[model samples]
Target: MNSTTQATLIKVPAVTLGFWIIKILATTLGETGGDAVSMSMALGYLISSALFMLLFVAMVLWQIRATDFQPLRYWATILASTTVGTTLADFATRSLGIGYGGGSLLLLTLLGLTLFCWQRLLGTIDITSVSNTKAQLFYWLTIMFSQTLGTALGDWTADSTDLGYLFAAGVFSGLLLFIVLLAYFSHISRTALFWAAFVLTRPLGAVVGDFLDKPLAQGGLELSRYSASAALLTSMLLLIILLPQRAALKTH
Candidate 1:
């Protein structure tokens, strides 16, 4: 493809093992960092949500205006979305008294509606089609909802079922493994599998984050959230720098 075509390629990273690794770390950082500000710092969910939402909006606009795929900008936006999603989900489920199940169902419904509209309007929900502003909007919106839903779902599984955080993480990790197997062994839709993995990773990260920081009395290690967030953030940055980052090739 020519330079112009390349420039118009999707402003998201190509799906690769490295991408998934970094994504999980980002989501884990989101959980820890969000809790650090909202819970540890006593900012409360509403204020934290507002702050993170503003940051997410700014990052998304910056990402949308970029002329080509910029790995740093793209990942930064993803982190912002996840952090905002964490706080927003917490606010909805706990502060609003919606409960985890209620919040998950509500966010899941929103995600379904967003995907349905995107598919109806664009005829495809593939990430490779996220080359233009409209598609980017839909892509980010879907991702935000998925992240929020993941948070609520993770909390519900861990807290409501007596499964504990590690067990909950295991559950999500197992589901992700199943998706990977289907991707290789079945004729399942690649796009659907990609989304399935994407959604599952968030919950895995969420529970893992909780496990790292929650009190021992609550089955967590009681580690400092700030330190955990810093470690996860550093790990993500290292992986991004060490691994090749390239835009997903646009598909006709």
Candidate 2:
């Protein structure tokens, strides 16, 4: 790695209320935007996934090549992953004729495999050590799989388990709350808790997004997906503009 590259490591954001709010909003926007292209615009899941995957690759390349962390660029990459996740999950569940249960199971297995391989190769799952190219690659790959898994898990809970979208969202949110408690009060491994919380947030966002757009009979507010996505996008943009996004300090 270059001297500059060695100085720049991917660090987790401070665990704050604002961070969680932005994360949930980003995930919700991911669901609505992904659905807009794949379902509302009549594009098949395969095509949508391909398009978003390409976009994700480009954004990740840009992020990885940058000398230092840029919050806008980093978050853009995150959004791309979520969009790709949505389409990939939809393809597996609907297009491939896998029911929600099967899709969730398949994604869960893939997620576990990714984590296993990553750990075997890297020896650690610490985000603080993600200063090198290989570590960053593994980090992003794990994120993609987790997001896809979240989509399927969300749908399985809402549809197959008959929990309803609102209730499913509540369940995930409650789990997130527990993670927060663990982080603050318990002596759990921070790395493990971080990944668990990160994975759970995706599904929480999915369920909340569904609850907003689905039919009244399905326990949703029945809002327009496009409008909700637009609003969320606008909010994110405004926050990015208003907040002070500083790069991580270079370590010796």
Task: Specify the poorest-scoring 10-residue window by lDDT in model 1.
Answer: 1-10
- Predicted structure with the largest TM-score when compared to the true one: 1
Q: Any runs in candidate 1 off by more than 4 Å, and if so which? A: 1-4
Instruction: Give the number of the best model, judged by lDDT.
Output: 1
Position 192, candidate 2: lDDT: 91
| lDDT tens digits, residue span 90-112, model 1 | 99999999999999999999999
lDDT of each: 0.92, 0.83
Q: List the residue pairs that clash in candidate 2.
A: none
Note the clash tally of each candidate: 0, 0
C-alpha lDDT of candidate 2 relative to the true structure: 0.83
